[model samples]
Target: MGVVNVTPDSFSDGGEWFEPDAAVRHGLDVLAAGADLVDVGGESTRPGAERPSVEEELRRVVPVVRALAAEGAVVSVDTMRAEVARAAVEAGAAIVNDVSGGLADESMVPWVAHAGLAFVAMHWRGHSTSMQSRAVYDDVVADVCRELAERRDALLAAGIRQDLLVLDPGLGFAKTAEHNWALLAALPVLHGLGHPLLLGASRKTFLGRLGRHPGEPLRPPAERDVETTATSVLAAMAGLWCVRVHDVASTVRAIAVVEAAMEHAPEEGPA
Candidate 1:
């Protein structure tokens, strides 16, 4: 999966693709670079961000989704609104990637079920403005898995097909850097939930903070591709279903190598 933020305030590459033409071009670029899906989001979900008006979100996202899907790129609307998702589907989106996991909008789950679109249900605690305060957890991995399972059950109960649902741990949504790392290490445990997993650790703040000296500035989001690629490689090795990334080509190449290496590994256990 590749990320295409159509808003002016996403944590990374926001205004860079705010224009429909530019976003469409970017969508094509990522697809050519080997992304199986292009995720187009209008609203910024960065911590402390405010919600965009539904009208503004629809205006921002529908055209890009329409253009990208027309060009034959598989498109996922990264929205938490049923209205936007409905319009994007009408415009040609095949999947709805909701960060709120049907919790943000009351109408989201039923609408998704009615449309029969594939849904990426991320584990979310609250909206961006206050979500960070909700990061509390007894055990990050177990809590995330338990919450995700609750979401999965709710989504299924709302009429979404079990197979069409994909789980995302909401990597940086309400998580501290340590929490994100812990979840990364527990990818297999997340997979134990009986659903395919989507990992979106690409260029996130946690990756940006890695290895930085005390009092030094964190790595810029655009410069975190190296860490993003490494994490994507690890996630792939851990049986992740997909990785939402800003830099798709490099991760694609790395995963290809991983696949090739796995193909030729000896049958005996390493130990």
Candidate 2:
């Protein structure tokens, strides 16, 4: 998956593709670069970012989704609102990548179920503006896994098909740098939940922090592509079903390398 943020305030690449034409072209570029799907998000969920009204988000995303789908691209609408998801699906989105995991909108699960689209349920504690305050966790990995399990069970009870769902342990939503690293390291634990995993660590602030030197400013979001690619490769090796990234080309190449490496590895004999 490749990210196309059609908002003016996303933490990374905001305003760069805010225009519909630019966003559509970027989506095409992502597909050309080997992404299986393009995730178009009109609202910026960066920490402390303000929410956009439904009308504005619809205006920004619907056209882009329509254009991309018209071009035969698999598109995912990255939204928290059921109304936006409904509109995007009608406009040509085949997937609903709800960062809130149906927590933000009560109608989201039912709507997704009725629409029969792929659903990405991200682990979210709260909306971006207040998420930071909710980041406290005794054991970040275990807590996240438990909470995400609860969400999965709830969605199942609400009529969402298990096979149509994907889980994302949201990297930066309300997590610290340590927490993000812990989650990445615990991919196997998350995978044990019996659902396909979607890892979205592309150009996030935690990657920037990892690249920072003492007494130096953190690397910018754009500069974290290298680390993001590394994460993509590792995620692929860990059997993640997909990785959401801003720079699709690099990640595609990285996953290719991982695949080739695994393909050539010696087979194990029975222990």
Model 2 segments more than 4 A misplaced: none
Residue 215 lDDT in candidate 1: 88
Give a tens-digit lDDT track for model 2, residues 91-168.
999999999999999999998887777899999999998999999999999899999999999998988898999999
TM-score, one value per model: 0.97, 0.98
Give model 2's TM-score versus the native structure.
Answer: 0.98
**Which lDDT value does model 1 have at 167?**
92
Give the clash count for model 1.
Answer: 0
Candidate 1 lDDT by residue in tens digits, 1-271: 9999998987887589998899899999999999999999999999999999999999999999999999998999999999999999999999999999999899999988987879999999999999999999999999999999988998899999988999999999899999999999888888788989999999999888889998889999999999999999999899899999999999999999899999998899788
Which runs of model 1 end up more than 4 angstroms from their true locations?
268-271
